[model samples]
Target: MDQPTRPSKTIACLSALIKIGSSQAYALFDSGSNTDSMTPEYANAIRGPRIKLTEQVTLQLGCIGS
Candidate 1:
């Protein structure tokens, strides 16, 4: 049987909610959003092959702004 391949580096994410004075604060530690939230500078820091969405999708629009 062929063994699975392992990446050179591993990524992990942790989320927790802590009670504050009058509200709860969410704490997130991870690579960050998958939807490309990193700045151009930070994106260049990654040292691996990056996959980007290339499919062109059509979005249906209803009459609203007219």
Candidate 2:
């Protein structure tokens, strides 16, 4: 079963390109989104500490023009 959809609304968001360690990345800001995502290359480039989570998460994104 699919989750109930929320009302789609257009809102202003802030996005910026910032340097993470040596590499740079585009950071997205979405107040309505339930989850955040990043590429493995970016994470590796940062070389931050890794912590194992007790639970895993699933990220679902709707395709354009469904």
Q: What TM-score, over all chains together, does every model reach? A: 0.25, 0.56
Model 1 residue 55 CA deviation (Å) reads 50
lDDT of 2: 0.75
lDDT of 2 by residue, 1-66 (tens): 876776667444689997766777889887789776677776777895566879997777778766
Question: lDDT of all predictions, in order shown?
Answer: 0.51, 0.75
Best by TM-score: 2
Off by over 4 Å in 2: 1-13, 18-24
Model 1: clashing residue pairs? none
Q: What is the model-wide C-alpha lDDT for candidate 1?
A: 0.51
- Report residue 8 deviation for candidate 1 (angstroms): 15
Give residue 58's lDDT in candidate 1 (0 to 100).
50
Per-residue accuracy of model 1 over 13-63 as CA lDDT, tens digit each: 576885544545565644633432323543455433456759953544346
Tell me how many clashing residue pairs each candidate has.
0, 0
